[model samples]
Target: MQAKHQLATPAKVLESYRSPLNGARLQQEKVENLALSEQIDQFIYAYLQFNSKYQNATADGKIPHPTKAKLLSQQRNKLDTELETLCSRSSSIFDQKERGKTLVMAVDEYLLTFLQLSFVGQRSPNTLEKMIGRKKRLLEFLTYKFNIIDLSLDKLQYQFIDQYYTFLLVQKNVMENTARNRCNV
Candidate 1:
């Protein structure tokens, strides 16, 4: 199924279109197709084919809705991040030579992707559970505290680390030592 993007009026478009940078980044790594959903693969293919479509479409200087604009920005950032990862990885499941291989890959490669991963399943259920939990907390801290919906790991600063630490200690009621330990984890 195709993802539905809303149509906007000319008045809702931006003046002087420009491509935006990704809000988050992933480390360099090649991945198997089994690790990626076909929807994401298709989205990447389609987005690549029309990299400038968003710029062209936003001709005026406004957005039809704030939420729609936010969503668009998120999607654009995700595309940038994945493309950057593919570039840095030097290979892809889509690469002919990579058709059949057992490569050592980090779980972060897929976890950090814009796509959602279920909290259940995985080789070690506890690891996956903790990952999902920490991710949720980090996202909540960024969004609720900083009003930052699109988290740019590349732009993460000490302020974020501090805020997260405080959040752990105060909001989550984790001991200071335990919060530090969790951060270490």
Candidate 2:
């Protein structure tokens, strides 16, 4: 009886060890989605700001104007569709069994495109790496502070970035120049 009980205990332990339980947050996918959403929001903000200024200038007839309004409208529509797609991709974050490779790839492509469009030219490798690192830190901080399991665009704010920088200074003991470099990087 004692020998049987000992063998059964090991078997039970093995069974529990192999139990299929996966409730932990998918942090990588969530962070990636959040970053992609941030990129989209930043691009839209840039586009709208420029479009508004361009429209105002055209209305004032400051120069020999072309049909820039049509171009802006087309870009807005495209951004709307992309935003919808981002929402759809974010929805997948809740589906525990679903793999997000396609969603990730799409976001990656859009992010690269957004970077190219925003820069309009080549960037130094250091600058590009710094931007990526800052984004990574921001996502990590948000995840820690907010228990943000899903990377939704609505969670991000300009104020969050400021708070995150402050967090690095006070909590991480980062110096002013180091914090500024990390934030801007």
lDDT tens string, model 1, 41-110? 4444455344345444566864436675676777767766765665455245434442332211222344
- Model 2 residue pairs with clashes: 130-185, 131-185
TM-score of 2: 0.34
TM-score per candidate, chains pooled: 0.39, 0.34
Highest lDDT: give the candidate number.
2
Error of 2 at 79 (Å): 26
Mind giving the per-residue lDDT tens digits that candidate 2 earns over 1-185?
Answer: 24544655767777757764442444555566557566555654554465455557567566524666666666667766665666466445434446444423344444555554543435433344445555556556756777653444444567766887888898778899988877653
Model 2: runs farther than 4 Å from truth? 1-111, 114-121, 149-151, 155-159, 180-185
How many residue pairs collide in each prediction?
6, 2
Task: Give RMSD (Å) of candidate 1 vs. truth.
Answer: 21.5
Candidate 1 versus the native: TM-score?
A: 0.39
